[model samples]
Target chain A: MSDTKTKKKRKEKPPIEEPLLAPGHRACSGCGESLGAKLVMDAAGPNTYATCCTGCLEVFSTPYPESAWKMPWIHSLFENSSAVAAGIEAALIAQGRDKDVNIIAMGGDGGTADIGIGCLSGMLERGHNILYVCFDNEAYMNTGVQRSGLTPFDARTSTSPPGKRSWGNKTTKKNLPGIAGAHGIPYVATATVGYPNDLINKVKKALKIQGPKYMQVHVPCPLGWIHPTDQTIEIAKLAVLTGLIPIYEMEYGEVTRVRKIGKNRRPVEDYLKPQGRFRHLFAKGAEAEEELEKIRQIAEDNIKKFGLA
Target chain B: MARPRPAGYVAEPGSSKANKTGSWRTEKPVFLHDTCTDCRICVLVCPDGIIFGADSIYDADFDFCKGCGICAAECPVDDIEMAPEVR
Candidate 1:
C-alpha cells in the first residue's frame, strides 16, 4: 500500500475531422511526405493549385499519365517549382483572380534546401503570394539518398554510404526556415506530420498570409531513413522532444513563437535508437553511434540557442 | 493516487501565427562563466571553425556560428546556455 498507484489518463486529442489525400494511392508504407501532404491538402484544397518538384511525390502521385490527384496539380523540374509557381501567381494576379486561387510549391530536401532555393528565395523576396511547403525526408529520395545539403551527417543514405573512413552525410542539414526567414517574407513556420493539428494550423496560417510564406514540414522517410513504417510518428515525436527539430513560427524575417519542449530530453540516443536508420550506432567497434550522439547534442543546442520552449 | 500531466501550452485551435517579432533566426549564445569549467570542449566541437582562443577559452562568431552548437556540447561543463529571453 506504500506505492501510490497513479494512472495518468491519455490526452484524448479530438478525432481528426476528415481525410484529404484519399487512399488507394501508391506511396511507400512509411512515406513521411504522404502524411505531410495530407495535412497540406486539407488546409489548401478544393480551390488550390498544387505543384510538386520532380521527386518521390511527383513519381508516386503521378505515375505517368495516370495521376491520383483529383485537385488541380502540376509537376515540374527539380529546380524550377518556385519559378513556375511564381508565374502561376502572376497570371492569376494579372487576371484579377488571385483571391480565388492558392498556389503551393512542394519539393523534397534536395529541391528546396539545394537546387530550388534560388528561385524559392526570389519568389519570397518579390513578395509573391504562394505557400512553399518542403517535405524534408532528409535527402534526395528519388535520386538515391545522396548527401544533399539537408541530409543530416552520420546518417547512411545511398550516396552518403558508411565506409571504413568516412561518416555518412558529412555536412549538417541546412537551416531552411532560417534561410527562408532572411527574405523578409510575411510568414514562415515549421511543422511535423506527427502533430497533425499543429501542422494543419500552420498551413492554414501560411495560406492566410498576404505575401509569400514558407512551411518546412519534417517528414521522415522509411526508404532512405532505415526506420519503420509504424513508428514514423513516434520517431518524429522524438525529434521534437530531443530538440532536434524545434517547431517554430517566424514573421517578416523574425522568429515569433515556439512549441513547448517535453520535460525529459534524455540524450540524443533516446531519439536515435529504436530505428534501423541509426542501427550502426549500436554495432560493434563503431563510433558511428557516438557521432550521431553529437548530432543529437547539436539538436539540443538548437533548442537552447533558439529558446524553443 | 494520480500522476500529474506536465504543463505545456499549445497554440489555440484555428489561430494564426502571424505575430511579428523584432528579429528572426537571431539566437545569440551567452557563456555562463560561473558554471563554466573552461574544459574547452566547445573549442574543439564547433562545427564552424570559429570557437578557438588562448588558454582553452572559446568565442562564437555569431555571423559565422550558424547557431549550430558543437561548442556548447564541447564544453565539458554546462558553461554555455542560450541568452535570456528577449527580442
Candidate 2:
C-alpha cells in the first residue's frame, strides 16, 4: 500500500503525443475556429465521431488530397450536419453501441444559425444523444464575409456595406442560445475561444449528459473581423469583458451559471475599435453616436438578462 | 480505370501532417526558456496545435508551426517573442 501511494504521488503529467486535430491544415494564422475545433475534439477524446457542415471548418481542414482530423469524420451539405449526426446516432443505437460512442455536429454561424437551423431544431426536438457546436464568427466567412442571421447590428459585411443611405447590418444578432434552450434540452451553453479551460470543461460536461446538448462558441475570424491575426484571443476576451457576449450555462430552459462581469465591465468601443469591420461606427457624426448607443443598449440588455453583474 | 472512393474519404487519416505549413510563417516564435513559467498557454492558444510538452519543458514542432504569434501574444510570462524568420 505504501509503495502504491508513492507511485501515485510521483505520477507526472503525460505529454500530448498527437492532437486529435492534427497540424498542417490550411486554416489561416490565428484562426479562432481551428483552435476551437481542436479544443472541442481534445475534450471529446478518441471514441467520438464528428459531422461537419459545408463551411470554413470543412474546407480548410479537408482539402482534396488531405485531412487534418484524426477521428472518424463526415461532411454533408450546409444544412444537414445535425441530421447526419442524428443518422449516426440511430445507427449506433441499432448496433447497441450508442452508449459507448459520442456524436458531435459542427458548423459555422452561417450554417448553424441560418441554413441549418431547421435541421438543428429537428435534431434537438427529437432528443438525439448528440452535441451540436456552432462556431459563430458572426458572418458567412467561408464565402467572403457575407452577412448571416447571427451577424450583429451595424457590422460591415460585403453584402451589408455602409453607404450613403444605410448603416452596416440592419438587424441585431439572433438569440441562438435562447432558441436552443427553448427546446428544453438537457444542456445549453455559450462559450468563447478566449477562455480555453472553461470551453473544454463545458464540452466535457455536455458530453457526459445523455440528451441533446448545444454549445455556441464565439470564434473570432481575423480576416473576416479585420483584426490583427495575433489579436484573436485578445479580441475574443474583449467581447466577453465588454458585456457584448455573456458566457453562461442553461439547463432545461433556465440559466444556472453565469460568468459575472462585475467591476471588469468595459464599454463596447473597447471591443469594436479593434476590428475594422466596425470602423464605420466610429466616423464623426450624430448618427454614429446614435448607433453606438444602440449597440451599448444591446450589451446592457445582455448583462441584465444573464445577470452577469 | 478505377472508381473513386466514396465521398472522397481519406485512406490515411491525419495526412495533412505531410503538408509543411511552416513555410507560410513570416515571423517565428523564439522561446526564452530561462524565464519560462511553463504555464502552457502557448500550447492551448496555438491554432496550429503544434506545441507539445510536459513537466516544464515545452516546445513547438517547427515543421507545422505557422508562426501565428498567438502563443507569443497570449504568453503571460513574455517568454515568447515573434522574430522575423531568417531563412
Candidate 3:
C-alpha cells in the first residue's frame, strides 16, 4: 500500500453534509436567496455575526424570534444593514473582541444597491473589518418586485411594469463593484449562487484579509422572478453565460480578475425567456432584442473596461 | 483633513460612481519593476485595446485601459500590477 492510497482511503464520506440552515423557515421551494445565505453561513463558520437588512431574505428567513440562523444575527432597517453592521463592528472593536468572530453584513440588491447605497458606500470608505454581501435577485422582491438600482433595464418589475409606453426599468443598473472599488477597499468580488465553491472560496479568502471586503452574488428569486423553483441554478448560470452578468474581482478599485465570457454565448433570450418578468419581451413587436443588447453592452463594457474577456 | 498618501505608492481610487456620469475609466495598471521580466503577459492578456508593442513600448493607455487588471494577474513575471483606483 502506498502512502497516498492510505491518505485517500481515510477521507470519510465528507461528514454527511450537515445542514447549516435548518428547514422550516419561510423560504420558497428552491429559493436561491436561502441557498446563498446557507453558503455564506457555511463559509463564515459558527462564530459569525450577521447583520441583515430588511427584504424577502430578512423577512422570510428570520421572522420575529424564529430565525433560521444558528449564530448571532441582527436586523436593522430595510436599508441600514450596512450601517448597523458597522456599529456592531465598532462595538466589537471597543470590547477588544475582533478575533475569531466574522462580521458579515447582508441584504438583497434592493437594500444594498438602491435604498442603502449611501450607507454601503460610507461603510466601505470607513474601512471597517467586515464582509458585505449583497444577495442580488435584481429587483425589489419584497416590495412586490419593483425596480431597484440593481434591476436590469427592461425587466418587468411591478414598479417598472412593462407596457407599450415603458420598457421596464429605463435606467441601467448601477455598478456597485465600481462604486465599492472606488472606495479603495481591500477586496471586492462578484459571484453567483450557481458556483458555490467559488463563492465559499472568496468568502474564506475575505475572512483572512485584514480590511473590509465586498461580495455581490446573483441569486434567482423564483417567486418574484416568476420562475420555476428548479430553474434557480439554471437561470443563474445562464445570466453569466450571456452578457447579462459578468463575474470579476476588484482590489482597491482596480479589476483583478474576470471570468471569461463563456465560449457558447447563449442568446440573451435564453436567459430572459424563462422568467415571468421578461414575459412582455415576447409580446408583438416587443423590440426587447434591442434593449437586451444594450444590457449586453453594459456587461461587455465591464469586461473590456475591466479586461474580463 | 486626512493626510493623503505619498505620491510614490499608488493608492486605490477613493471615489464614488453614482455622481459619476460618463464612461470614465476605473482601474489602472502599474509596473512591478522587480518581478516584471518585461514579459508582455499583461499586454497579451489585456482584452481592452491598451498595452504597447513588444519592442518595449511601455505604454498603458488609460483612455481605453478601463483599469481591468488582466495584465497584472496574467503577468508571469509579476511585472504588471494594479494600482488603487484613486479618482
- Could you report the Cα RMSD, in angstroms, for every candidate shown? 19.5, 4.2, 19.2
Off by over 4 Å in 3: A1-10, B1-87
Fnat value of model 3? 0.00
Residues A211-273 of candidate 1 have per-residue lDDT tens digits of 888999998877677775545666777788888888899998788988878565656677778
| Candidate 3: Cα lDDT at B68 | 40
Q: Write the per-residue lDDT of candidate 3 for residues A141-245, one digit (tens) a residue.
A: 876888889988778888888876887878877888888888999999999876667888889988888888999999988878898654677788888887678
CAPRI class assigned to model 3: incorrect
> In candidate 2, which residue ranges exceed 4 Å CA deviation?
A1-11, B1-7
Q: Put down candidate 2 lDDT per residue, A204-259, tens digits, no spaces.
A: 99999999999999999998999998999999999999889899999999999999
Pick the lDDT winner: 2
Tens-digit lDDT track of model 1 for B12-63: 2112112111123244456765454444445422322234443324565443
Expressed as tens digits, the lDDT of each residue in B1-87 for candidate 2 is: 897667655635798888999999899998876556556788888888898876555888999888888998999978789999989
TM-score of B-chain for each predicted structure, in order: 0.52, 0.84, 0.57
Worst 10 residues of 2 chain A by lDDT: A1-10
Cα error of candidate 1 at position A307, Å: 1.3
Candidate 3's TM-score: 0.73
**DockQ score, prediction 1:** 0.01
> What's the CA error at residue A122 for candidate 1, in Å?
1.1
